[model samples]
Target: MSVSPFRIALIVDGEYISAWQYLMLERLLASPHAVLVVVIFRQSVATTLSQRLNAVLLKVLHALDGRFFSCKPTAQTPTSFLPLLGDVGCYAHGSKRYQTFVSTQRVDVAIELTGQAVLPEMVASTTHGVWRHFYGNPVHWWDDYTNIREYARRQDEIVSGVVRYMAGQAAADCVFYATTSTDKVSINRGVERTLWKMADFIPQRLHELATVGEALFQRNMRERVLARPLSSQDAVAPGLITTCRIALRYPSNFLRKLYKFLFRQEQWILLTTSHGNVTELGLLENFHKWIPPRDRFWADPFVVEQAGEQYIFFEELIYARGIGHLACVRLQPDGSHTEPVKILEKPYHLSYPFVFKHQGQYYLIPETAGNHTVEVYRCEEFPHRWVFEKNLMESVEAYDATLQEYDGRWWMFVSMRSHQSCSPNEALYLFHADDPLSTQWQAHPQNPVVASAAQARPAGRMFTDAEQLYRPSQNCAGVYGRGLNLNRITQLDQECYREEVVSSYLPDGDFDMNGMHTLGIGRGLSVSDAVYIHRRLGRLDHWIGKLSGFIDQLVWKHCYVLMVLPLTFLWLDM
Candidate 1:
């Protein structure tokens, strides 16, 4: 094992690469702990005329739909000039020329961006062989697989991961995996968002290799699950029929957006009850409801009880402000509530007031992702006021950061966003420290420990039931906050982490419940929240907005969208 920086090889298609791949290269090259020792490029062969036409059509739609619907201006380009760094050898992989050049270089680890499985020869040439991205849910690691855009459009989600190919090993090592929601309106947007997030996979692994040393890194890699085996399949360009199907699906997409903007407003309300397993969604209708007015929504409820008095903390977002603020309300014995009081307000959006007790003192770490930091606040006055404590993390888009004490150490669980458009609901990261309020924390070697929309984001504080530690997670699969998953922590330590979903609590169809995320329990008081869909058809505050939104949709989709269709064909291959 060596503590020195790693000598890396960048293997890719020659001359040009996708913009997202270029981003990966930039991150890899920028790392002070990694040095680019050599590059092995495999030039792309020619494609059929139909394939070229398919690419052109995809380019036009991607440029238009991503920016138009997703409002992403800086979409990743399919083709970008590749930066030739270190000793470069643009030779066909596995060829005699490639073998000669690769053998001459002293490579620790190789990053393969050519969308190909690591060949046994390449694995033998390097110390740790190559790391590559594999796609699919159970992971379809096939030689010729469906394009991710088509897969996302068809499947409504994308799951991909990076794996380490160790020399002489039968199975590759799983380093990272993520299940991201697909932008149903725009397949290209979905692909763009997913790739931007997955770009960090290799760079993080490289960092571990450098700092943790090869022996521990390799051992930990093996401790995780093995990568899926690569299967063979025939792939081709999307032909006329597939293309027409894609075009036709947009009509429904337009209708869905129109329905949302015109007739509906996502009004999240909070539900609370005195007792029951809040993890179980049954009997929620019996719980009292805290509905907000049409102008805003109240959600993410965390009820705290002190000295026989209970206070409910939540996020209140007024429509005019378009940002969330921390607010709390005191619960009366007669099941009544006081007027909501603003507790802590910041210029940036804040939600998920993760309040917990540490050594007889109350501390709060809310989701301050808008400021790009996980900030901590200490409660000076019970239930209402707090002072700054410490910045636990910085310059990171971490969400719903929930901290818990386990194994005589403090652990923090959070969902992280790798890129701007990347969803934080897809990957859960773990960090630990000796002190609960410590600014410096050690990240778990295998992060994210779990990567699935069904169980990635922390729903609320971790609690124990029947002496078994349980953590609540949000199922943000098809819809945000669709349900809550109670996961039993099977393993948690400095080197490894694991959890199993013991039970799932989704909205009761009989209760007309739409979604839920947070759950609060302790002091003989248990509380959780649920959302019900409410149409703004009759509300006075939304009637005029409904009419205006209807017209806006018509004008934008029917007129503007149609007008740009022909222009996209003329935008040239991008």
Candidate 2:
């Protein structure tokens, strides 16, 4: 039997609508099992000089490019414009015309994307409920760390913009929420671009919102529900003096850049400790460093134990190639290691050599996403030679392809970046197959099961402790690979997927490490990698290294151009 779509209505601040908000509306219209019945746009009186300028610019653009560049109602659904002559919340709720329209449409739910507070009494008397979408720091408006100079200058603390959705009319009634960190580049581009970036995942989030809304409504009917008390963290608007000071200091960031160029070093270091010690301490202590030769680093370490012997596989990145290859080393019982050996190489960049054993056969699935394919290789000899096995997936940009077997199925968890995505590490995708090497893989109904950089990217191996399966994820909140998040997989299937974060490990010891991304354990030994700033050379060497790395990146980006240039010269000479 076919079920009816949820009838939804939007209450938006027409004065604030931009290209980004339009994109959100477009995505909502595209969602399955959801129908936008009516849109109510509340127009606010323009006060600021910037607001007045924007209004005039929008009018001119609309005259030239038509509705494409305008903030007016463009969706096919019915819409009504309401002018707010007084307080926005009180005017909206008290207007008889608005109330009549809501009654006529019979909206099952209402959503406010205006970032304005709606009274709880008004919301309860209206539709089933309302959801509010906030695009900046909800608790605090201005912070010293805001990505945009405008906001930073105005506020003393950094402005950490959040794309958040809160349920219920009151602030305390927020039941479901998701947050993504905004960088300076994104914030300076304005709200339209921010919304456009968020549009990639907001559609999926709306579906989740609908599901949660229905479930909460039913539960509310069965039992009395009370709103949680609001916390004391209130936001204060920024003053002009603070804003001017911040703007003046913004240009001085070049000094910090120069300092970083002079002294900053990013070197990947590997460490080993007892598994029990890691669980108890929540941080690794007393570790031995596995430092490679000059201008080379070892990372993404995977360990395999066989016949009382341990072998560690990692990605060895050399400065010249500017690409990584699968490398291995033998781990001795006395905690010493042998020299590293290159095991596998390809013309394209490769890293995250995820190795595992199945049916007594050793197989490897390194990140060949740069080549636009996911492939498996079989090790013919221990820790040295490997032959191409099969392509599990193709034409996809997937990273850190981690695999595990559960409930008689082979499941692969990877971070996928869509062509439209602004960041690659934020979206988590799943694929399952009956055979470990099967090419016929099925995507989860909810492909991007998680969409936050803080928890989506797979870091290393998945293991079971006390019958509970835990997956290690990268915490890319402040920076990529900043820490490790351990999540317990509570449910997994075609229709549904869920996981809860159990514990986290951060680099907080003597290493002065900035990041720890990978974690692997086998035969009572756990291996992890930490990133630290190492000043390896003086100023001259540093500049040379920088130039070399730049050239490598250029070569990687336009290898095809280099190939075509030689061919073109040969043809011209002939």
Candidate 3:
């Protein structure tokens, strides 16, 4: 006989919902047999009506799409009351006044995201019980170092008391944990109990949950990767911020610095191709006074020098979004250029113009991150026409890939934020580019050359100056968001590389109070050095984005201040 779908009770303490959790929720609910019961903890009466309605709307949307869920708001209880003696919170007990609510419902499994302090006795005694402690991993637990002291204090209080640990033992028959290493060796020690590798758990009380949330996690990954549309075009958010600023902020900002070092001193010429208000390539360069007739966004400038002849190939964005085709322009020695000539046009979007020559053969590499696969192209005839030769680095998750030839070996590096735990999965993945045309790409045994999501990611090619290699990367540690910390890769080899804080652009000169992300980088004719193009997606990006801050402020104020009205509505609805 086929098994009935597992009934899942997703327990959330308050307003924290990770992208990974959201994706897995959708996947688990994808099975028609499974039922999702979302238990939302309402801590305060001040939450806004709109916020409450939206929360219900979210559950309703999921239910309408085939999920079976209900939102239950209990009283705001303190973590101290829980019987569990662990760092996590407790909420297993029904609200003091809501005993009937627990008696009326049957939860097959109670999966707690990260409210370890709230797992009460009433909540634990449910049938076939299980709880997923998402914060058990070291990588994620230290995402905010500042919260460590506060969390540690709470942990001591819980362990000293017997209720917390005992409640944990009594609540669930099984415990599911996600962690890379134990606390003794790895940085994330003592945050929670890990049953993954360690056998220190009380076997008599809890069985290990081996459900391998892999399938569930993969579904979530696919949704995020496919959600972004392939084509995109926007002005290189203005400013001449140094590479150091971006590298220090976004972890991928170093690519900008490496480029500047390689070509910063040369005098290059400027050639304006199409004049359109929608296009931003030239306006940021002080061409805003005169408006052109054509409304098209051009690709990053492509420069090639051979036998005293320089050729430039750029993309034209026809509708201000879709990348049209490769256009070629001839450049004079003084940096002056001829009219741009359209060369090749493909149905797919393309940008990040990269051109290199080897053994008399010219090749091009574009930011094919949107294609979800890596591909290389060969110049069939110069300027406009080319043909796709091979696809490299298949079945990998990454964006913004750049290739480099170093020490007689070819290396292809890309930025990837892997699936599952999201503590800066943005790391540099290297592959051996055996042949220009062959797709036989081999990953370096140490796959992730750089692990710091705040650093190691590339904004462009690992540019070189005087035989010394340097990379432009983003630095994201310290603050939530602000400016870049341009880093210089002093040394790189098979084992690892060292980066130096060349310069940074943190607001108020505080390195620990800002963040930055690099978008693109390349060598241009106008300047001798490699120009790294970047954007500072600071806290302003979040607080100013689509009224998100306003919505959050309204929600918090209303939910906490005017709770009686919504409570009445809920009581009536029930």
Candidate 4:
């Protein structure tokens, strides 16, 4: 049976509609279950000359480079603009014109995308309760307590300013919804990336809000109203001068990058140990490093002890292909490891070769997200060959597919990102089945069990100690793979899931590395990977490597532009 479409009414600020709001509008129109019935654009009664000039400049820039310069609304808005009095609250109870418009359109749900308090109580009094998009500071108040760098202070202020300018057109409703970030990168490009990344999340979130509004309207209309009212304290207003100072930091950021490139080298993985006790490995001085060959870097190490022999499996990333292949090396009794041999390779990239024993048979589940499927491979020959088995999940963009048996059930944890998302490190999803190899899988009731990147993406294998299970997660707060957080699973089942962070591991010492991300242990042998800047500027190989990398980055960045240039020129000539 098909359900009827829900009518969604949008209350937008006409004089200023942000790119995020415009994207949300487009997403709503594209949704099948929701139809945009009315667009009540609240226009200001008066505007200063400067404001009008800025608006005109924005319109001209959008016409030329709309995709990159998508900061304001365009002439391409789909819905007809219904201009309403901006100061509807000053009127008697509610503006008669606005109330009449709502009543005539029969709006089932009203959404305020322009974080303004221009929404009158009369609108909610007539239609379903109003739901507001509460855009707040990029960095939360709690982030100050973290061990982030000093540069993040100014960057956060700048981001907060941009969010306020774009979203603070009107007063938001009580139930505030916003995205939180703990990233500590201070460069201007980092700030720009964060802002653009958050914009991609608005559409999906708005659709979810509309779905919730529909369910609440059907259940209890009055209960749908937010209990806590929005106040001035809920919003952040960064000063104009401070915002300008932050924007000025962008030119200097290029200098910082150049300095790093000339002084530092590329990041390579370092192998380390923790004796028999993985938790006791606290400081960097305690472990010895295992350096690989010059042409390849090894990372994402997973150790497995079978019978009396121990094997360390990891990703051997070739510099030329820029793709990783599964490699393995035997750990000798003397604490030394043999040279790694490539055991598995595919047309697409692979990493995180999580090996385990199930029913006395060895199996591997490598990170095959590049193939758009999560697959399992059965060991055809010990420590060498693997034959393809059935795919656990297909047609899903997932990464770091970690599997473990817990409480008599096989649970697989993976990170999934939306099609629009650039990083897959923000949403952790779970699937469980009676058998590890079963085709039938059930998604957890609370999908994306963990949403924040700080503790969502799996770093390596999950382990158990003292009757408690702990999962290793990537601490992407400062940057990707900046550190690792060990989270203890307090509660996990089909209905609910919860965890508490037990410990954090950061890279420090003479290695001059930013972070340590992966950790795996088995049978007195603990293996982990650390990232460090590897420089060889004075050497001939360094120049060759540098030239190759430059070409690679250039081609990757402009591949689409190169494809379209010829067609564009041909069309122009015609």
lDDT (CA) per prediction: 0.72, 0.62, 0.41, 0.59
lDDT of 3 by residue, 125-204 (tens): 55544444322232121111211221221211101000112234533211222122111111122222121112111120
TM-score, every prediction: 0.83, 0.70, 0.43, 0.70
TM-score of 4: 0.70
lDDT of 2 by residue, 1-574 (tens): 1336667666666544544445555676667856776566666434577545544543343233233324332321223333312222322544786777645546555666553565343366444456544334445321221233333322211212223233342343433223343332223322222334544444554454455455633442222112112223325443333333333333334444566577677788787876773344237565556767768888898889877799899999998899999899998879889999999999988899999889989999999988989999998998799999989999988899999999989999998864432455767888899988999988775557775656889989898888888888988754567788888888887656678777787773235566888987878778888886675465564566567557645654454565467779999999
Q: Which stretches of candidate 2 lie over 4 Å from their true place?
A: 11-16, 48-101, 115-128, 137-176, 182-197, 209-213, 216-233, 241-245, 248-252, 278-284, 380-382, 387-396, 419-421, 430-452, 488-503, 536-574
**Candidate 1 local lDDT, 1-574, one digit each (tens):** 2466778877777676666677778888888778876677776657678767876776666666666675543435555544446444456667887777777767788887775556677788887777887665324442122234443245545667787777777877676666677666776656666777767878877776765676777666655444222233224334544555566557757876786687655667887766666346325665677787878888787877788888888899998999999999998878778999989999999899888888899999989988999999999998888998989899999999999888899999999977886787988999999998888888876777777777889988788877888888888876688888888887788866767777887773335467788877756666677776665555653555457557645644455355567779778645
Best by TM-score: 1
Worst 10 contiguous positions by lDDT, candidate 3:
155-164
- Over 4 Å off, model 1: 70-75, 78-98, 115-120, 137-154, 164-175, 209-239, 277-286, 508-510, 536-574
RMSD of 4: 11.4
Task: Evaluate model 1: give its TM-score.
Answer: 0.83
Ten residues in a row with the worst lDDT in model 2? 221-230
**For candidate 3, what is the TM-score?**
0.43
Write candidate 4's Cα lDDT for 59-87 as tens digits. 44334333433433222333432233232
